[model samples]
Target chain A: MPPAASPVPCKPLFFDLALNHIGFPSLDHKLPVKGAEAASPASAGEANKPDQPGGLSGLVKGLWGWGSKK
Target chain B: MAHNIKNVRIQAAYAELKKLIDQGSYSRIIKTTNKIVNDDQSQPEAWQCKVVAYIQLDQFKEAINAINKAPNRQQMQFELAYSQYRLNKVAAAIDTLDSAPDKDSPRGKELRAQILYRLEQHSECYTVYRELLRTTADDMDMERTTNMAAVQVHRVELGQCPVPS
Candidate 1:
């Protein structure tokens, strides 16, 4: 008579090597335009400061202050 | 300037693909990789990503097809063998692994040991596991030890001594 099959459930250690091998360009570096845009808002905010005593900057600050009061 | 724009577009596409992979969005990976490969058939990484996505989806046949489309079959032998193993094409899987350049790699040995176990070649499996345990560090030796123990149990069940030593 043939022996009974072993009950131990031995299975293959399946894994994908492609996950490690498939290389893609790193996304760590921001695009030049994106970097410029990120800096724009901070500069624009500084320029719109109410303490600035001059032309377009002061005019924009006055409008912003007036709008905030309403 | 044109070349730089094209490079940026390629980088953006890869970034999106990486995000999709991290999220386990296999379907989206397939779609995105398909587009990338269509634009450049020479992109082996795109083919690999598509194959991996198909495997994750349990579509072994599709995975095999994608592997076949890869620019370099030698580099994808492990993937081809793995998909074959999953599909229950055991003999073919062994053949594929045998043809691989790095067939002696740890991963390749592990897969081969598993295949041997499936084929009821317990002694051969035990030898493979033993070699793996010898070469690998203690921390990574757990799986090899467990597999070797299982193989030993089978050997004893077959009325053979667990180990000659």
Candidate 2:
């Protein structure tokens, strides 16, 4: 009698580490409003003050003034 | 609003699916993805997740079916070919790959090389592996090098020169 044929061993195939490669979609979420931090009480008070500029300009002015004083 | 509620439901479903995937829960992923797709048949991500889960479970036919229903089938050509390859439909896999827009991608090339190796086209397989090695980073060279060595071994077994001239 003839012997039964055995199955061949298949080599391992390399796959991407992440599901993103398989077309899995990312979570869709809304971005926070820009300058939302300015709404904080401390920052709002600082912004409302007559002399202080708001946000980036305020930070830059503070830095420049500090440098000039030195 | 109704729109907000729907968005929240979809978000929660996706979050659960992500958690299931991280846990390697293939069955749960299939169940969850099925529910998601039932609620919204146009959810390409749900179809994609179901296909991947089916493949992981060695259910290639089911994977292929899920892929057929996906809205973004064109973008999932590699995955379709992969499932076909797992099913031992090598020629079909190759045909599917030939139609892929990103056939030149590293993953696509790697899969093509594997199918060529299975078909015993060693020289073609070697050329693909060489191309991959040339582009692969040093840290990721181990697997490609191993595959290249296997090709050389097969060549030697066939009484040909181990290394290509």
Candidate 3:
């Protein structure tokens, strides 16, 4: 009986080599976390804020606040 | 941290394998693929598809393995291509992607994106999602937009639901 060829070495999984297709830099380090930074409005500042979800009470406060500003 | 370290080790090894292949140490790829084939259960749709991909430059070998290890006759090419893509066989992936059937194209990208996403490669998924939106979408822009928004809300990676605007 012929000897089976030594099962070749297990190759690496090469995770980020696939990312080369998408043009992300640093294949070995640093993936951008989605929405982590943009989730908080305070750091990004008030003028840049998109509408936030507020209950009816907050809406009343907002209206009053708007009147006070004028 | 052990599992994370192990994962990093595996990734590094694969990168080395890819580097060897790129450096014209091509014979190692065959040996490497053989190893993967043996360590694995030869289960269809498992990572065995990747082994088949490295043989693309050799049509007969690639075709044979692809036919044998493929999940199905239909999905074989894309599966193989996805594997090669992982191994940094970029040209091979593009070739496989191109030769595959039109119906298979979306499936191919989805599978590739899926593999990447599982590895925590969300950026690639985002790229593929944008490309898929091109072919899968139609004149109904508003509807597609609404549907995708809902899909994002659902956070289901594989679902291709079209939301109503």
- Regions of candidate 3 where Cα sits further than 4 Å from its true position: A1-70, B1-13, B42-55, B70-74, B78-165
User: lDDT by residue for model 2 over A1-70, one digit each (tens)?
Assistant: 9899999856544433212345445533311222465677888887777665558877787899899999
- What are the per-residue Cα lDDT tens digits for candidate 3 across B7-101? 55444445554555456554565554454435443433223324333443444445446455544545455545565555656566667666767
For candidate 2, what is the interface RMSD?
Answer: 5.1
Off by over 4 Å in 2: A1-25, A28-70, B1-5, B162-165
Candidate 2 chain B lDDT trough over 10 residues, lowest sum: B156-165
Tell me the lDDT of model 2 at B25.
94
Interface RMSD of each: 5.7, 5.1, 15.0
Instruction: Give per-residue CA lDDT, model 3, range A1-70, as digits (tens).
Output: 9998787633223223222222111223211222344466765665353466668876888899999999
Listed models, DockQ each: 0.06, 0.11, 0.02
Model 2, residue B131: distance off in Å is 0.6
lDDT (CA) for every model shown? 0.74, 0.77, 0.48
Q: How much does candidate 1 score in TM-score?
A: 0.67
Give the per-residue lDDT digits (tens) of candidate 2, residues B1-165. 986777667667887888787888999999988877777788877887888888778898988988888897887888898888877899998999999998998778888888887778888988999998898665557767877778887877777664465
Provide the lDDT at A47 for model 2.
74
Q: Note the residue pairs that clash in candidate 1.
A: none
Show pairs that collide, candidate 2: none
User: In every candidate, what fraction of the native interface contacts is reproduced?
Assistant: 0.00, 0.16, 0.00
